[model samples]
Target: MRLDKFLKVSRLIKRRTLAKEVCDQGRVSVNGKPAKAGTNVAVGDEISIRFGQKTVTARVEAIRESVKKEDAGQMFTIVKEEPTVEEEQASSNL
Candidate 1:
């Protein structure tokens, strides 16, 4: 499955176009390597996405054309989520 499609269908990014834009800007990576919107994804592939102040890493569990909202979370397993250096520092000082 395409990275952008998978991101949208899994509700990771909410929209396919946004996923493509994020990928194009190099905010998305697969298996530790930067990935493009058209990148192919398979089960077990680890995907990491940068979202402003935080980064979310998830492992692909399944690839489907479509899934219900309630089933979306089953598509990937969140490995970890951490704030960016700046965010972490700011929070630490609070």
Candidate 2:
């Protein structure tokens, strides 16, 4: 499935257009490389999204067109976040 569609179907970004916009601006990556809206996404792929104040990483567990809200938690698993530049360096210097 397309990355944009997967983000929406998985309830990651909420809207497809927003996903496309964020992707076009290079705020999204798949498997550690930058990805575009049309990028193909499959199971087990890692997806990272950057928002203004936060970054979210999730590993794709399954792809589905529609899923119940109660079952949305089964779609993907959240991974450890990348520490901000300052925090990372600070920790390393500790």
Highest TM-score, which number? Answer: 1
Q: What range of 10 consecutive residues in model 2 has the weakest lDDT sum?
A: 80-89
Residue-pair clash count for candidate 1 = 0
lDDT of 1 by residue, 1-94 (tens): 9999999999999999999999999999999999999999999999999999999999999999999999999999999999977899999999
Error of 1 at 85 (Å): 3.1
Q: What is the Cα-based lDDT of residue 26 in candidate 2? A: 96
TM-score of each: 0.92, 0.85
RMSD in Å for all candidates: 1.6, 2.8
**Cα error, candidate 2, residue 94 (Å):** 17
